[model samples]
Target: MSFVRTLRQATAADHEMVDAHYGGFALDRQADYRSFLTAHARALPAVERALAEASDLPPWRSRTALLAADLHALDAPIPAPLPFQPGAAAERWGALYVIEGSRLGGQLLARSVPAGLPSAYLAAHHLPGEWRRLLTTLDTHAAGQGQAWQDAALAGARACFALYARAAAIA
Candidate 1:
């Protein structure tokens, strides 16, 4: 199935969706996020495929930061300035999705933990602590306003990579 190309085109309605998706501590979009993920998770491979059409992770990373730009466009006060063109904020979200997908897929880090046992057992037990760390980082950023959403997104993605790396080492 094809992922929504409108995510790339980023229409006005898309901006509303991005804002709604990240509703966090202040805005409380967490429930929406959960619902969205549950509804969209199965379709993410199409997004990944579309992202792969891009040259590298940075483009996706930039996409994840699209919210900041949108907020700015909408005159929403962010703690910092946005690093991308207006209407392109969802790029950051897309990037975050790509980063997590890579980690989950074990392309960069094994999706298992080794307790001096067989690899199969390791794969069965995902490290909650690692997942927590990644989620916390994401939630932390998702909760607040920022100027450089791209930078923040990159930082969050890096944290996820580190978490996965640690898990892979243990596996």
Candidate 2:
């Protein structure tokens, strides 16, 4: 099995826990949707900023900006700025793994959004081969890891999921 697969299995419980906190696709009101976007806005920029600071990775478009646009279109206030400290390079990759993987699900979530609502964040701008690139990068990062590096990366990914859970509470 590839390291990405291993990482997925290792983090499976955390993934399920985070998903449980997000009120699902059955939202009946625009208010619920706005709250959901606002919660995402609160959490994503921090993770993105940390990734930016720690790695020389080429830019993938910022979902924070996309979320802000959707929030504005919905008349929801943008979330206030939050401080996010950068992590080590390996840790940043781990956190990024969660963020980037969400784009795949965002494609599905975008389908369920009400017709009249803005869905730019879910309708992420496509970059050909982005997921494959990120997966290859992650696999390479994991290739030579010692237990300590693996631990740090797992912790970073878990921290990201926990951050979203906290944001979900506020939403």
- Candidate 2 at 148: error in angstroms? 1.6
TM-score of 2: 0.91
* Superposed Cα deviation of residue 6, candidate 1 (Å): 19
Q: Deviation in angstroms for 40 in model 1?
A: 21
The CA lDDT at 151 in model 2 is: 72
User: Model 1: how far is 109 from its true place, Å?
Assistant: 12
Best by TM-score: 2
Candidate 1 lDDT, 1-171, residue by residue in tens: 112232223333433343343232121243332232222222233344444554433322222233233333334433321122212343445445434444443321222222321122112222456544545554454446354654444433333333323322221
Model 2: per-residue Cα lDDT over 8-105, one tens digit each: 99899989987898856254368888888888888898888787676445456678888989999998899864555546566776788889888887
TM-scores, all candidates, are 0.22, 0.91
Q: In model 1, state the lDDT of residue 34.
A: 29
**Alpha-carbon lDDT, every model:** 0.34, 0.79
